[model samples]
Target: MELLGLDSFNLVVRHGGFGAASRACGQPKATLSRRVRDLEESLGVRLIERGGRSLRLTDEGAVLHAQTASPVEAINDALNDIRAGLGRPSGRLRISAPILFANTALGVLAAKFIEAYPDVILEISTEDRFVDLAADDLDVVIRANPRPDDTLVGRCFMRNELVLVAPPGLSRPARVEGSAERLTFPAVMRMGTGDDDVWTIIDADDGLPRRYHPKAVLRLSSPLTIRNAVLAGAGAALVPRTVVAEDLASGQLISWGTASGPEIEVWVLHASRRLVSPKVTAFVNFVCDHFNAPTR
Candidate 1:
């Protein structure tokens, strides 16, 4: 089949309909429809099922789409890279990151990046769930975990540690020597459904590990929310230090300094198969430099 026909078909499938694809590609809807029909006729198979108010791909169409999508994307990326190499980086870069990180330092960093690379369009998605980068057509995904995924090639820019913190001026019982005295304050937990209701911490004096189950006063799924609750004197919570570094610095919250939780590893992941575009490489390097600097 011709490359033009295949490109039109890909656009239609990606945008879900001819009307949307036409608007996106700056082509007439009739022209796009004709291209796809010509492609199907040349292939001798029904690619799409047309009906009232909706479009569905046939079995053959799905197979062809799955086979061609990656190659087409790679070709497009390569062409874009060539054009960008000739001049300044000028293309759309789509990224996905967690909501907490997006709301924190990532936003500032993104703004700085945009200011530095005025020609590139930066699109960011702040969602808690993991997004399939290739399937979703995203260029990069920033995530926090203990290790990078073996499937993707990326860089770990920072190490995030969870800390136990409380609102400033909250009274607490003093630690007794050689005693595992449990604190009686209510706990604010950042937990999802089916998560265990316990926290592990190490004794600062003895360096021994122990698990403490505080009375659950507020349970939330977002670290930012838990930090805000802790700042409001709701209860002590275990949260990533990045989420509350300013609060801890300003004495809005008090760090318990209990190094019991695991450190969260932050990574920027890209697809392993596609060639790393100039825009993607620039972003990865900028973020790494920003976080890895000595002052940070």
Candidate 2:
């Protein structure tokens, strides 16, 4: 298989169609189609099925793409390394991030990052779902409380414990720890990992852990939505303090206490590779420095 054809095929898959790939790379649409067709003919296997409304990758196509995407990237990185020689970060940097974080905070961070490194072209795709670094062709992914994965490596940039918050007009519930007649407050909550609806938190005043039952009146999908519900006096919600910090300071929201669960840790990670790209290192260090983390 010709390397040019392989590159064209990957580009088409990456951009979702030949036309889009042409538009993205400023290549002739017919040339890309011919290259991809040549690539399939050379490999003796059909990669993209174009008989539908849009192009969909066949099983073989997916496997080939996943197998080749990183190696091709490594080749590009090698060339970039030789030319740039640890100079200013350059090239397209693709990233995946969580939805709420992207909407709330990422815009500002992207602006600052771009201002600092003008040569690098930043592309961000926001989704709450986990994505593959190689399969998705992404340089980095930002996640909250990600499980241990040997394939990934990075540093936690933000660590804030969950806190229960209510509207400013709501009165604090009477603390009745371990009491049979404990108060169950009306709360806007997401589905808990456990079966029971309860808030185990550290009392801000006493600095001791407390348990409070929460009756979920409305179930929300994301913390951002829960915060909105809490703001509308829908009910109390367990959210990160950083999420509601500004509201608390403005006296628009009141924190009941910090939850006694794992801290809400946000991390920026990339796939573990032999030679880390300068752009990747630059972005990671930029994030670490912004978050006051000395190192990963």
Residues 1-296, candidate 2: write the lDDT tens digits. Answer: 57788788888888889889999989999999999899899889999998877879999999999888776766677577668765568889999999988988889989999999988899999998879888778889999999899989999998888888999787777866466544578888885534376667887788977778887788888889999999999989888787899999999998778978678889999988635788889999988887797563
RMSD of 1: 3.1
Kindly list the per-residue Cα lDDT of model 1 for residues 104-173, writing each as its tens digit: 8787999999899887899999987867776677888998882445657788888888777888677654
Name the top lDDT candidate. Answer: 2
TM-score of model 2 relative to the true fold?
0.85
lDDT of every model, 2 decimals: 0.79, 0.85
Best model number under TM-score: 1
RMSD of 2: 3.0
- Model 2 spans with C-alpha error above 4 angstroms: 1-5, 16-23, 26-59, 84-86, 176-181, 191-195
Which residues of candidate 1, in runs, are more than 4 Å off? 146-148, 174-184, 193-198, 202-211, 293-296
